[model samples]
Target: MSIAEQFPYKIELHVHLDGAIRTETIVETAKRRNIHFPWETIEELKTHLVMSAPPYHLGALLEKFHTFMPVVAGDRDAIHQIAYEFCEDCKKHDVFYTEARYSPQLFANKMSDGSKPPYAHTEGDITPREVVNIICNAFEKGSQDFGVKVKSILCCVEHAPEWSNEVLELCKEFKPRGVVAIDIACGDLDPDVPHKELHTRAFQLAAQYGIHRTVHAGESGPAAGVRLALDEMHAERIGHGYKVVDDAELYERCRRENIHFEVCPLSSVKTGSVPDDLDKHPLHRFINDEVNFSINTDDPIVLDNDLTSDYEMVMKMGLDKEHVIATIFHAARSCFAPPEEKKQILAELVKVYGEKYMKM
Candidate 1:
């Protein structure tokens, strides 16, 4: 039977909030905030958001993405709305659960109207704490409204080490509100910055608070990046760990350590972090090695994909159905949610899929 004919199970672990925002919503929010968008139409804006231009470069692509952020700037309500939309999209893809991450520092600013008090060392603005609250609040509401479980993580953009500390503080403050993990995300083209310094600090802080840690490594960097994140940062999971396949020792280490990799197939292809052809992806090799990993849509908006499409790609690539099921469970095991929560979700997924597809 074809892989799709056998049915597939899925769970997502590494998605970004800003990159997941709906393009239509971006336009609407821009209009509401009186920010002018360069695109004449929503379709054009989406094209830019997804980087449809031939021959993509990470730095230049990110620069283009920043052009749309002003609309979301100083807008807590818009952030909440975007969060809701993200959960709704997850549900549409049959993703029972998701752990979305965002950089709180990016949204830590006063309203465009400048009504609220300013944060320290800046003109009147909100604090990173405020941004975390807004994001968590939205997730709470979305979970309740959609019957789709969702949790969030505060991401520390590795480019700025000073700002990373602020994110760590916010993560500590929001621990009670279901913020379960801390992530370091940014372009890996230039490894000169040494993620170890900040990641080690973040991991130490998370360990102090008993929060889980994950890091974006090995996507566009050398295989050593994966080793550093695992050894130095002590990450519980590696996001977009494409380079691990290139280093047998690191791959073996990951297997021995049972480290989870949050693989985003479409994002890898779009960004040229991996071969565009699905058949060429090393995910099959990882699966065969029994490497614990999960499929995810890193930036659903930019990749125009979700958990369903990610699973579809696996099927299209000829992955075994039984292995797909096993991977989903592996993903559940790797979730940063509390053990009890993970158990409950796993049981629920097994019950549903087992009855529909796995039963003899």
Candidate 2:
């Protein structure tokens, strides 16, 4: 059978909730709030959010964040809409199970007027408790309505180290409601960003509370960032460790430790974090080294790709069908679910695709 007919694939470990907002949904939400978006068309919206030229400097990042912020803010209805829509999209992509991450604290606030905020607001301005509730409720509803399962991971912004504790505290409270992990996201440019100090505290707290830990590293920075994430931050999984190939030792350490790299192929290429050419992606090196990793579309809406398309990219890069199935199973193994649940999902995947495609 062709890969498309493989029926089902059982995992997606890396997806950003805010980044998955549909372009038209953003436009509609903005219109409802009387907030004027800069773009005239959905295509323009997609470009503004995902396809813009970038070294992804602070200015560009802020601009992109501002564009999507309105869609997620305001009342619980907006949050529910975006979250439910995300699950719908996941079902379409055949993502049986997923771990979706976002900074819930960032989604708080209503538009006072059409004008933008003069400066970024710290976590002090928003109630973390309310943000977590909004996110958890949406995820609960999505599962009930669509039969697609998801686990929410509260993500702390790396640039805002001061808010790390508050974010972790919120994650602790939401753990009973299916919030499974905590992550540190945002760019990794400044060498002295205090990622070590901040993530260390959060990781320790998560460990104490028995929640999983992950962090974004090496996507936009050097290979050393990946090492720091593992060594200093105690990250259980590394999000987009694209530069791991640059450090043989770190790559080996990840393989030995069984640390999963949530590699977002489309996002990496679109954001210029990886080479524009798919063939040049460090994923090839990861495959050769047998490093533990999984494919994801970091921002399906923004990157204009999905899990299926990500898999197709791997195939296009000449990974054979066996490797493709193995890659899918690798992703299933990396998910944040409990061990028993993961085992069940893995079995289901094997039953569906393994036997038929194993020798391909």
Candidate 3:
């Protein structure tokens, strides 16, 4: 076996639960419900889930989700099945820890607008907290069955600050129930977000309640957006902060502040956040400067990736084995677990990876 394959211990800190749903599971769920799919076979269905070769713009990547979400709309059991399978997949990969995130508010009954008619397929009548419970329960069950420590994060969208207040409460209520953090993903600092004020307030309140906070920035947005997410939003970590490397000063600021990056190389390549040139990627700078980072599958199934491929890609890009090990520990330190628990995980990793390679 190759070094990457033989090497054990992995932690994926930036994976999206909704985006990583198994395409087969999706097909089965749709078939069980008698929902029509354009593709009759799973092989054909993958073409829709995975993005095409170049020009992987973030907007186009996000549009792919619309194809699947509607298939299981309003079906709590289907959501549970996906979540359970995510854990099983993690176990197959030998992933020791995960911080999987999903937007519970998206599962709730989407209210209709005054001008437009009600949507035909709605996850109707489901309360936001109910959505949280359904997702959390499945992760908790998966954790017990697969022996993978799972931490769930409640995701808030950039354009729906009005919905964040309920999300804040959900984070607080489910903290002990597997919801460890709250995050904003998708876009960054869009003017269309009517409830920016509400979003600011919700994040502040969540911090007070001891909920961990992260934000998706610097991927498709500029470096300044990452600064805003950190300075104004007080985010502990930045998801896909690829553009931060554009500003040397800001990149230095991240290193100084101990803000870790949940770097997903394949997703970056597929999303066009980084150029196709591996040598030009910011991760090299992050590795050389000793900045903390973690290799992750941002959307494993959606992007046709996994933790092993992420680790393998870094090695293919010439990242030293020692540095690759550092990234793994960096991810472990940022797992949203308490200090004591985090220390325990790090110690176990040291034993597995050998004390010589650890940053400690």
Candidate 4:
């Protein structure tokens, strides 16, 4: 049987909202908005949007965003449609629950101070705060309509520390709505780049004010980045943390502390974060040592994968069906949903997969 057929229910914690936008949405939005997009058809656009080959570096994948983000950024209708469609896509992928993450500032055409936006072609009335509100509203409606629980994680761009404080505030304001966590996403995790003070302060305050934290570290960077995420950022989970295995002491510390590593098998290869050879994947150590981790698709649009694609990648890497089930439980336990909602999610998982898989 196929992995999706075997495990029809799943939980995903590390997918990016911007990275998962539908190609059709981009093409349509570009034409509707008169954005002068060069690619007219979905098939043609995907050749540029999707990373089917490599250099396979993180920077190359991020460059894919520049192609379509400008088309949708700063547009209210486009933002709402993507968030709503994301919920439907989640249900199609059998993702019962998900925490879709993105940088709200990237979606807005203008900053609160009347400055230009990052990805938009021109500045306009929409602010980062408004972007959050739109996504929250869309997610709430989409969840009810699609029968999939979707939450948002506001991201602090690694290169743009200036926006970190506002990202924190947005997380706080929308916590009761649909927002659940704060993450440091985007930009390359270059080891030489000095950690920004503003980013650190925001995360520290996030912890102080009880906002859940996750950081994208140790994917392409060194294991020290993972250590910094745990120490300074107080990350509850590490996103795409494949390199932690390189440092035995740090890896052991993570295992002892039960820090959840969001593993993305296809993405790791697509972005060249891991070796091209699946047999030499660090996930083998993670499985053998019984470290706490969960499988995920980091960027479906760019990597040309969904939840099932990631599951099949790992299954082909020698993981059994039981191992796949355990990761779903790990995601459930590590998700940023409120205690009551989390309980319901766990109960549903048990209902579908049974109590025995919980022990695996």
Candidate 2 residue lDDT tens string, 1-360: 655566366478888888788888877776776665678678778766775565643234435766677554654667778888888877777777998998865776522222332222322233456767877788788877777888899888777776678778877788888888989887763346764576677778777788888888888788887777776666888888887878888777788888888887767776677776677888888788777788787776656777777778778887777777777778777788888988888778878775553332
- Sort by lDDT, best first: 4, 3, 1, 2
Question: What's the CA error at residue 158 for candidate 1, in Å?
Answer: 1.4
lDDT string, candidate 4, 1-360, tens digits: 777799889999999999999999999999999989899999999888788866889888888888989999999999999999999999898998999999999999989866678888888888999999999999999999999999999999999888999999999999999789999988544445665778878999999999999999999888888988889888899998899989999999999999999888888887888988778899999999998889999888888899998888888889988998999999999999999999999999999999997776
- Where does the lowest 10-residue lDDT sum fall in candidate 2? 111-120
lDDT of 4 at 2: 70
For residues 81-127, could you state the per-residue lDDT of candidate 3 as single tens digits? 88888889889898878989988765555422212111126446556
lDDT, candidates in the order shown = 0.74, 0.74, 0.80, 0.90
**Candidate 1 residue lDDT tens string, 1-360:** 543334433577888888788888988887776665677578988777775665754565456556666667557788789888887877766676889998876666653333342222233345567778878888888888877878888887776665666677777778889898888886752346754476568777777778888988888777787877777777899998898889998888888998898988777777778876667687978877778888888876667776766777876777756667777777887898888888888788777566332221
The C-alpha stretches of model 3 lying farther than 4 A from their native spots are: 110-120, 189-194, 357-360
What CA root-mean-square deviation does each model show from the true structure?
4.1, 4.0, 2.4, 1.1
Residue 292 miss distance in model 1 (angstroms):
0.7
Off by over 4 Å in 2: 1-3, 52-62, 110-126, 189-191, 194-196, 355-360
Superposition error at 65 for model 1 (Å): 2.2
Give per-model TM-scores: 0.89, 0.88, 0.93, 0.98
Candidate 3 collision pairs: none
lDDT of 4 at 132: 96
RMSD in Å for candidate 4, one decimal?
Answer: 1.1
Error of 4 at 88 (Å): 0.6
What would you estimate as the lDDT of candidate 1?
0.74
